[model samples]
Target: MASPQKTSRKAAGTRAAIRRARPASGRAHSGDAGDDIGLDALVGHAGYAVRRFQLWIFQDFIKTLATVDIRPTQYAVKNVIGANPGLSQMAVAKRLGIERARLVHLLDSLEERDFVSRIPSTIDRRSHALHLTTRGKAALAQFKRLAAEHERHVAEKIGKANREQLLRILACFT
Candidate 1:
């Protein structure tokens, strides 16, 4: 992985943009005290490192999902429905860190594709309970396989121990 972008200080209370450079040898180099570490120190700022890593992982996800005709959010909603049949739309939205209103559009698209169904919530007439259709179940299985491949690729890039530690530390922020 590349080092974090250059880090600078514009003011006492603000941070400057982080910048990174690649060596001619094609190796990643994090900044050290002797080097102009600035804000670009990959080891110095966890957030910067994580942001770059997230973009890397997302790119991998996009590549792996290209053949599926479904967005990551759509797959996640379906996965949630598969795991918790009859879950309320609001609950799915909350679990996915998305707005309930946004979820409605996603649900509509899925329903149109016959991947899922929305039934009236037994607990609340005004609410909806989500369920995956047979097609959606099959799609989820395929997605799981793709996800496993994605994870394996990432693990290979960042060692398994580092990957596990990274996930554990990231969960703390959430």
Candidate 2:
């Protein structure tokens, strides 16, 4: 095996090479270093663009609903449950791409807040049916209103026509 001092020196040399490669503009790069690593290659990739857009949407959504004290996933889960009352937990997990255990934790928090209830399933005794309580319905209504405002912000950022086109394009993936 290489000596510890040799490994340390090699690592330091690698870091120095990275520093030398960085742009001289002094602006922070995307991943690391205090320089821009021109994103020409990433700019053309659809997945990269989509990920960047998703990040922006999430940040804006979180900021918009900061007062509501809800996260993007929580909002999505509650919305799905609100719309599909009496849905099975596993069904919800599948629909929302959330793991069963993670969904249970989210449901626990919502139940504690009186925003959701897990009732005994009529069809499957092993599974629980999810539903929103009266308070949850009211809260969901408010959430929808704020979410609309967030959508409006999105529309403003990207014009209505572009947003519609983007949605049409993204629908293929969903």
Best by lDDT: 2
Model 2 ranges off by over 4 Å: 1-35
Name the regions of candidate 1 deviating beyond 4 angstroms.
1-43
Candidate 1 lDDT over 1-174, as tens digits, reads 433442322332242222334233334456544434333345467678778888998888878878887677887898889999999999999988989889999999999988999998888999988999898899889988988888888999999998899899779655
lDDT of 2: 0.87
Residue 165 in model 1: lDDT:
90
Full-model lDDT for every candidate: 0.79, 0.87
Pairs with backbone N, CA or C atoms under 3 Å apart (clashes), candidate 2: none
**Candidate 2 structure quality by residue, lDDT tens digits, 49-120:** 789889999999999999989888999999999989999989999998999999999999999999999999
Q: What's the residue-level lDDT of 9 in candidate 2? A: 100
Instruction: Give per-model CA RMSD.
Output: 9.7, 12.8
